[model samples]
Structures are given as structure tokens and as C-alpha cells.
Target: MVHVYTGDTMIETTEEHPFWVEEKGWVLAGELNEGDVLRLKSGENVKVTKLERVDLKEPVKVYNFEVQDWHTYYVSDINVLVHNKAARYNTPTPVNPKRVDTNYLKKNGIDPHSLKYDTLGDGADISKYNIYVDKNGELWILKNGSKEFIPTYESIGR
Candidate 1:
């Protein structure tokens, strides 16, 4: 998922990557038009607009190792496998919460060890982002001015 920081808020979009033979099953980030539909790394199809505006300028932040080896260790085969597992680890299967959510595990009961928080770094400003966990057990980093990106469990407690 790629997000554009448009002064006030962020705009999100789902853009498909051109096929690459190196690694399979990754989504490349790029500009997202208004009505584009693409398959997520989770194998589920999502259409843009659950949150708000879609940005057409920001580059798609591709998380696949096959596309770009931004992370040095991720270039390895073993690391790729580990990353693949991490990507799906503890990820929610159902998209969102419906009536009578059985997964209400209580924020107070959530052990600090179980729930991890990472600072966006010193120079990075995420003030416009509203952080929230959905009823489906997915952690969302939403741009207050826009919409939510597909939540991934990869960065949690790592």
C-alpha cells in the first residue's frame, strides 16, 4: 500500500506491480488512480476508498524483496521465508468487525509485551496519523486527513 501526505492528511491507494520472476506474491507501490482494484499481499482483493482520498503522486512502497532489496538481510532466501511468515503472523483473516465482535480482548488487558509501539523516528512527523486497532485485531496507522492502509503484522513486536 502507498500513501501520499497531502499537507493536511494522507491519501492511500492500492497499485499492482508488474510481474517479476525473482520473487512471487508481492505488491509494488505506485500511483493509485481513483477506481483501481488490486490484490493485496494477503491474497485478498481490495478496492480503493474504504478510508478517503487516493493519491496519484506518491510512489508505491513495495514490500516485496523481489522488487527491490531495500533491506539488506531480506535479500537472502532464508530471510525471505522468515519475512513471508512475519507478514502473515497474527494477521486478521476477516476484513473488519461486524455485530457482536467476539475478539474484544480489552485494551487494558493487552499486555504491553503483546502490544508493541514504535516511534516514527525523530525526523518523521506522523502527527496527522491516527493510530488505532480495529475489532478484527489489525493495527491500523491511519492518516487523519485521509484513510487507512492495509494493516500488516510484520512490524509488530519485532
Candidate 2:
């Protein structure tokens, strides 16, 4: 964690290192408060200049990255239909054709339904999946097979 001195008070950076830009708005993480601390990769401690809760109603372009920004949504707020280590054929029957609506997941080359495991084409292991939340409040659908983030967003019905 990096420390930033603002006049007299020294603040400790928060858990997630999220960056915010005014023109593009907050991109990496969730809403930030005034006193919240952030540490940039450059080792500079940044304090939130303003308070904002981002709502990713649609896709927005920020920092040359076309990313989804969610302001009003929280991970817990979304009812995750499935989770770790469950048998695919048992319930929720992993939707085929992989109709996901996320951008980051698609970029990482993950096919949730037709997901291949062990190169034997032996379906996929549900235990290998993980969920991650970005600074922009966007949720990630990831497979543990690779170290990269998936860029596809499957359509999770409302």
C-alpha cells in the first residue's frame, strides 16, 4: 500500500487500485468517496477529487478502452445464477451458444458454454470458473485455465 500526504493527514491507499478520469469518468473501479485513497502504478497516491457512483447502462469509452462502467450495480446486488464447483448437467444446464453480453470476458477468449477442458474436448469443469469485479463495477466471467481475463459478456437476464 502507498501513502499519500495531503497537507497534514497521511492517507493509506484502498484495497483496489482503481483509476478515474474526468473526461471518460471513472473507468477502473466503483464509486469513490472524497477521502478514499488510491495508489497508481506510478507509486503516486491519489485522493478522489469528487464523489461518483457510476451506472453502466451501456458501453462507454474511457482511456482508449471500451469498457462497461457500473455505478449503481454491485456484485452482491446481482443474483449470480451459478457458482464454483457445481456439475454443469445437474442444474442451470450451462447455456449453449454462449450468449454473454460482457466485453472484457469476450476479449479473453472464453466460451462459457462450449468451454473446452484439458484439450480433450471433455466439456468444462465448473470448478475452474471464477468471478471478478473491476474498479468500474463490471463483473468478469473468467475460467481458471488461463491467466488472462475473458472478454465475453453472456446475457444474464434481468
Candidate 3:
């Protein structure tokens, strides 16, 4: 068993247990490291503080359940949300860009296939352009390097 101390709250579970993350989504406790961030009940981001292994003299029994509607629920006692066993270590599935989505990128002179992708990084640092689409579908160019690239943005939608 592993005791995860993250963002003032802690959870005790197997290394295979998955924890909900903000930008990266579900990640296994074993894969989690200090300096990584997790999400709280209030939708706030919290940094992972530490992790410890438990030496058990006897077996520790744990319970399991099925949540058909939402596979995730909050541990109110610890004030943190966790995904059910069914979603253990679940990562975002790669989806081929839609025709319109691809066309939109191509229209902006971005080669859709040229974009690098790594689920482990969760769509981060994939593009040399440093561009991302906001919730409102607005394209934002984040500042990079020595801050020579002035941050700029434009409204876009599918």
C-alpha cells in the first residue's frame, strides 16, 4: 500500500490506484511523483507533497464498487476526488483530428500531422508553436524562450 500526501489531503491505496489530475486527467499513484499537481473538491489545483510505502504485517482488505454514471467520486473525509478502480491509470485516448479541426489548423498554416503528441505529457510541449485552444475555442500563443515572443491570441471556433 502507498500513502499519498498531496495538497494537505492524503489517500491510502495500492500503487495501481488512480488519482484525478487537472490537466493530465487520471494518473496512477505509482507514476505520480512529488511536484506533480492534483485537483481538489473545489476545482482548485494542489501540488503533490510526498508519497510513502506501508509495510503491512497482514493483508489490508479494500472494497470496490461500480459507478455507471460517473466513475469518479470524492473522498469527503480527505476532501479529494478519486477515480474508481475501473478507471485505474486511465489516460486520454488519442483521437484523429476531425476534418474541420484539421482544416482549421491547416488554414492557419499548421500541419496537423506535424504536431507531436504524447499522452504521458498530456498534450503539453507537443507543438513548437506553443499554441492552444481555450475553452472558448480561442487560440492562444503562449510566450516561450527568452520572452522574446510576445504573447498573443485570437478567437477561433469549430
Clashes of each: 3, 22, 0
Compare the candidates by lDDT and give the number of the best one: 3
Candidate 3 backbone collisions, by pair = none
TM-score of each: 0.28, 0.20, 0.55
Query: Which RMSD does model 2 reach against the true structure?
Result: 16.2
Give the lowest summed-lDDT range of ten residues in model 2: 73-82
Off by over 4 Å in 3: 76-78, 86-88, 97-158
Report the lDDT tens digits of candidate 1 across residue range 1-158: 44523223343334332211111223333433433443322223334333334555766554544312111112211111112222332323435523211143243343222222221212224454444554555454444464434232322222
**Sort order, TM-score high to low:** 3, 1, 2
lDDT of each: 0.32, 0.33, 0.54
TM-score for model 1?
0.28
The positional error of residue 32 in candidate 1, measured at the CA in angstroms, is 14
Rank the models by lDDT, top first: 3, 2, 1
Q: After best superposition, candidate 1 residue 60: deviation in angstroms?
A: 29
Better of 1 and 3 by lDDT: 3
Encode model 2's per-residue lDDT on 43-127: one tens digit a residue: 2344544443444568554322223322111112111111121121121212222323336445655343333221111323545
